[model samples]
Target: MDTAYCTADGTPYYIANFAQLSESEIASKRRQLICVECRWPAYFKRAATSGQGACFGARPHAPTCSLGAPPSKKGPGSNEVQDILRNPMNHIRIDINYGAHDKVNGDPSDVDKANTRGGRFTGDGPRGPSPMNRRLRPLLKALIESEQFRNSNIIVELPRYTSLPANQLFVNFDAVDEGLANEFRGYWGLIFDTGMSADGSFWLNTGKYDDLSILITPEKYDDFKRKFNFQLDRELEGMHLLVLGKLRKAWSGKLIIDVDDVDRCALCDD
Candidate 1:
């Protein structure tokens, strides 16, 4: 998971920081981080040959994921190459080298991105609590002070760092001790599935994240909608198809929303 853009430990601590503002304002400012970190690798060669696109413009699931099977409307895996071909809901490669502008406009790294280019949004009140993460911090502080994690809800905490504990937000939530940590709130962010290419080469297709972006070309989006009986709301038809790619650690049949559409965007507000 290590990458030049991520922390030394390879976690995306920064992306979690975006929701503190209105989702739309994030793009005007925050995505600048992704554009610089992910899209523009210092070494030109690495940018072209080695990097996975910072912003995905397609689905997030690859065939190799545990729930490679379709969750939206399921039957059985199509044995035929054509059926698989007809519905590209299967594994698709994400082009690591993409125009910086395109990814930002798609789902955008943060919620507050839509109809914007650069700058930040501020001057607001009652924007809700700082975020769920802020609430988690004090809850963890109390657990450490009580010094009885055996009965405390603080789970997944790192071993004491010298005398300090790792922040509760970054503690590995997957490792939560269910028996003792049922009441402590935890954020169940979507789990994205990425994997190797059809040629058996590893690739970080962020599209496997189903929630990323559809990246459907203006031409293709229109063509698909006109040809099919399904009605893809005109606004969203252009966005990528979203569905949780995997089920192991993510929710089942979770709703998928177009990251850019004003309405679909609300599903993420949770």
Candidate 2:
């Protein structure tokens, strides 16, 4: 349940056990994560996008849509936080199947995915889908649902993020490293899964969300020590690894492709 994210300036943002939290805390962090996602340059505008690479700016990289105002971690949260308020238990039970199915955003429930909504496993190799753009969903949804989209004339994708604190990254990474008996450093928004496929498809496909780019900055990574003491909790560390191991086992080994390459998606051709 470790989650990873990058800021608009390309700084890494993460929280190790980001996914494994009480509905309240996870929902809170998710709000911050959403800001990071939409804070980028909109893809269509060259001014904003000329220097900006991530598709989060909401205006196609136009200076008009520059990530001009950096998000204050202390600012208001994203509405996706509403999920918890809408149905806390459903939010808890909405298994995202990180790395295996969709990268994050808890792959869409059965009713949403179509062949175009490719749901392959990342473990299956390059043929599978890529990791989820954990940040985009709520942020994009909010902007589009608001006057933001109405105010512009550009096509865009959602941003992804995990919205974890600095200390939590180490705690969760260490958890999954041991849990899955592998070296998974981080993930975006992910939830626990229910079961795995028999033939090793090992993944689920929820097309409700599209993928996003990762944002990493030197400051974001270097500030780790200032965030949390990694050595403080052994019990929580054990829990982290346990969660990862289970997540790996449930993956369908299909593909975790990004939404950017939909035309090439196997599901699309199928």
lDDT of 1: 0.24
Per-residue lDDT, model 1, residue 77, is 23
Instruction: Note the clash tally of each candidate.
Output: 14, 55
Candidate 1 regions with alpha-carbon error over 4 angstroms: 1-18, 22-25, 28-58, 67-238, 241-270
TM-scores, one per candidate: 0.17, 0.20
Relative to the true structure, how large is the alpha-carbon lDDT of every model? 0.24, 0.25
Model 2 over residues 225-247: C-alpha lDDT tens digits? Answer: 12222332111111111011112
State, as a TM-score between 0 and 1, how close model 2 is to the true structure: 0.20
Error of 1 at 7 (Å): 9.2
lDDT of 1 at 99: 21
TM-score of 1: 0.17
